[model samples]
Target chain A: MHREDFPMLKKDIIYFDNGATTLKPQCVIDSVVEYMTNHTSNIHRGDYDAAVITNKLYDNVRNIVSSFVNCDSREVIYTSGATQSLNMVVFGYMKKHLKKGDEVLLNKAEHASNILPWIILSKQIGIVIKYVPLDNNYELTLENIKRCVTFKTKVISLAQITNVIGDVRDVYNIGKFCHENNILFNVDGAQSVPHMRVDFKNCYMDFLSFSGHKMCGPTGVGILVGRYELLEDMDPLCYGGGMNSYFEENGDYELKSIPTRFEAGTTPIAQVIGLGEAIKYLMKIGMDNIHEHEMKLKQYLLDKVKDIPNIIVYNTSSNSGIFAFNIDGVFAQDTSIYLNSYNIYVRAGNHCAKELKDEINIKNTVRVSMYFYNNYNDVDRLVDALRNSKDIFKIVL
Target chain B: MDNDLRREIIMDNYNDPMNKGLIDDNSYLKTRTSSESCIDDLSFMMKIENNIIEDIRFDGEACAISTSATSIMIRILIGKTVDEAKKILNNYKNMIEEKDYDKNLLGELAVYDSISKQPNRKNCALLPNRAINNMLEELNKKNN
Candidate 1:
């Protein structure tokens, strides 16, 4: 692949922070810039030619995203980001569906974005929130889920791939269980959608949310894919001009259809169009190829760091892009600083999954997340830098 | 990589931290705090007898600046009166905040004077001092 496709990568920088947000491809950027500069218009509103073009482009991107996740366009709803999508599901659904004494089952390995919304909702409504403990390897097992679920269980929210440990769960099996028990299954796909292939139809999930920036697109755009019937039943999160069809003088208003009902006024049209271009780019490269490339880099890094004594590697089962580890005696932040001196960038905190660190009994671990753009040479450079700074970056036993 | 930002003593102490364990007895007051964003936790213990700090110990996991700052703090705080310790804590805070700190009084803390240059790590270096001040406040509240 041509590295020039991504203008951000041209700057002598080895960005290993893809898990935070990915570098936008030139195709995606051009798509966004074209829309912003030339064809800019309020979508689904004005009757002008520009507005018509804008509406088609916006809806086409929605169709593209729906196809990317193997769902219908009606199933895809745009939000500010994955966090907003998650909050929309938790708050929007719980307010309408969950009754007092209902239970929400969650995994201990969930990101704060996935967990905190449910936690807050549980506090607001009288729903009981319970956690399914991970096994020795930080994997959420069916057995654990069975132990955690009860008759009062109304929903099960989990991360498809843990941001910190890269532990991928069996969302299909979990979805099966939830469906069998009449529970709503919500999957946080922020970390998984970028590096892995996700088929909503095959997964049998009721709801799934993913951010665009994590998948080589621009920020401020995310998708929440939910079952058509379920989304129709759930109330809209935000009330606004775009979402309402007609309003009577006596406070009576008809809401727009699904997807638009959820999307409030002024959607991120340009970014969503750019996200479509991003999805097209990924489709050309193939998600499986991206997965294979990332796995190769992950294995290369693991192999290089394995022989180094006093180095702690987290999540060896990571088939995806995330690699979480710590130098034996060195603090994660210090190790990150030392690596930064070499122009290699890796996230060194809990990666916004605060509960996972405590659940895994780690204070902090350095995380090096891979992307399709990263190659073996990048891994080699990282290994060389780590090897050279063993004394400064190693933790004392 | 700025010369003024890098602390040689802080790095040395981080590599080889001193007084890095919990005090066994309950004679000392203990305060624990952690940075949720960075996931670094720190615990401070001051063994005070007759209103004088006899010994100090720290136990936690943190960055180089934090570990080294704690080590340097415990080393300097031993055998000082409570009032004197508060004065030293204030001086250390001022130094990290780039305020006009008395050069002669802040002896070993001068090693960390460059900490002002690295703004992000400034909180890590001041964790121990914050814990001490918080502990003193709690002690005063209890006495009242």
Candidate 2:
């Protein structure tokens, strides 16, 4: 809706790889620049004016994130990205609670960041990692989760919106189920939080993780919001200077409280401040409006591409703005290259979810993901590019 | 035509790759490789008898650049000695990287000379060659 806010849009590029990361808005950029240029000092350690301002701005971001996700600021923890946030949960909580023979149910289509940590923990601790079976469309439903759950199921981890399939899962319902069954609900909001408004308190999520870069903020910053009791019980994934309240001479240490306890050493102060600005920017535009715009653009693109011949679409029915497809007899990377010749950008390959190779029975596919800045003209450009690329197969074969 | 994106020779070989099947014989030394950036997954199989390349085959899914480069590679490696095949693979890589190389030795792989300018497709052109080098290394270790 506010394309002008992103300076990258002014360039001659039609970026459709928003699922990988979104273009940063000018307000986010300006905020980061302002921090770097004027308020350039470490937080929580210095007594200088810049340092105090930095510390105040840095700590206040937690409240911004808390209000954004409808969670308590004390529960907000800063991480490197969603990857680190997920690692903290697996290593911090699940590693301790899940025992041998305890099962953790996950979706087959979850991103690698969501699946790999659990897999590593399962291997290390002898916990059983199981998948909630998908229906024929390679889609998961609450019914599938109900069918998969057992008495031994200790945790349920899934992406609120899967990166590849773009399925907007009924995570609220699933979270309620987890609460009733005493199972920990971990939501990988890497794909969903930026696109939709998340009510962390109402969703019954024990933990929620999302990255800043995916929502018009800078990279290397993410949020991990957990229930206060759960976070208090969870061990710190990292240990260092600022995270501890006191330390003994013989190597004993009393850690700080939640949020600060998890965020050890120096944090990405500028990026986190920029993330706060990004959240405000999104809120100003209204998240519902942004979501409605994406759905409209998705429907428009789908309507245009549906008539293209010799195409295999994996998830056209997805309400989210991800279109995964492959042209018949053409490799996904080749199609991506052909599109690149037209100044179009799209993601191709298994998309880093290697375990999904067996479930979907397809090696690779091209993904065209959209964001709020994208419109029908970009979709038209992609359609024209695809139509023109048909000649490459003809010339080659 | 985007000359950098698609060359006629690349397309021809990609559409009709040579030696594009795996060897069933257990005697063939095999190794697989994939590019981290692109979807270029390939396996190279070679049957070297007394240091001479008796047979060579490649079988895997890859991008057009990789498939075509691999097809051209099989043609040059089928009848050469092990050391000679290694030399040719090395020279082909040097050529792709825009290094000094004997043009006559590269054969049809010389078409990949422009790949040096296209940085992203460089891995696509190198996937099968790297697999070949890896397979040779494994074979040498076994014989030693």
Question: Cα deviation in Å at residue A334, candidate 2?
Answer: 1.4
Q: Residues B23-132, candidate 1, lDDT per residue (tens digit)?
A: 68887788898865565688888777788888778887888777878888878888888898888999889988988777666666677786666676778878888888
Q: CA lDDT of A328 in candidate 2?
A: 90
Candidate 1 has an fnat equal to 0.67
| Tens digit of per-residue lDDT, candidate 2, span A29-70 | 999999999989987899999999888888888999988999
Whole-model Cα lDDT per candidate? 0.83, 0.87
Q: For residues B29-134, what per-residue lDDT tens digits would candidate 2 score against the true structure? A: 8888888877788887888888888887888789888999999888888889888898899898888888899988888888778776678889988988898888
DockQ for model 1 equals 0.42
**Clash pairs of candidate 1?**
A328-A395, A329-A395, A329-A396, A330-A394, A330-A395
Per-residue alpha-carbon lDDT of candidate 1 for residues A335-380, written as tens digits (9 for 90 to 100): 8878877889988887777778657898578989889898888888
